[model samples]
Target: MYIRERRRFVAMSLAAITLGACAETSVRPRQLAGADPARGRDAAERVVCAACHEIPGIAWPRGRMGGSLAGFGGRPLIAGRLPNQPDILVRWVRDAPSLIPGTGMPPQDLSPAEARDVAAFLYTLE
Candidate 1:
């Protein structure tokens, strides 16, 4: 009985570890480090992001000029061009026009840290 219980415990532990690893991989480290989704949401609101794109959590000043931010995290590409990574996403948020010339998404006045927070919030959209 002791051996059986020990085996079961080990199996459960392995399963838990595997699940945790999966969860961690889904979100990049940059998005996880010192990133606050709540603050990102607030930043989005302050920056009037909803004025162009329809954000899932924020429900105000929604506009149709930009693509909906729904499922943004799951997307494989940013701006339908760059890879969907934390660094790339942050840069895109900070200066979309710089990354992609003529992008309708105007450059934001957000600082680097603010952009990271925004990226964290966006990563939660999945």
Candidate 2:
């Protein structure tokens, strides 16, 4: 009976360890506060962004004039200048030329809310 009890205790301990491991590794995608990725995707489509660059999960066009927008969340900078933060991203999206004169990226007419959504979607690219 002692041997059976020891085996049962070991099994329970192992099960607990397994569950803890799963909890530690179960990570979900990052989300920006007050930003909607779905709305951002829709905005991208409406703006014809694919005509100049390749954005993941946004198929069609996929022009080569600009860099691909994959893995943007991991990137250190946006437009190779500004910090890759939500506020900076929103400003850049709304008016790239204003931020950096003569920038190839044209000023998009997206409102602050729309820019926020786009920034949120970009943050999910990791």
Candidate 1 segments whose C-alpha is farther than 4 A from its true place: 1-30
| TM of each candidate vs. truth | 0.75, 0.73
- Winning candidate number (TM-score): 1
Cα misplacement distance, residue 93 of candidate 1 (Å): 0.5
Candidates' RMSD to native:
11.2, 14.0
- RMSD of model 1, in Å? 11.2
Report the lDDT tens digits of candidate 2 across residue range 1-126.
999999999999999976754453233443457889889988988888889889999989898887898998777678887656666778887888888899999988788999989878887788
Clashing pairs in 2: none
Candidate lDDT values, in order: 0.85, 0.80
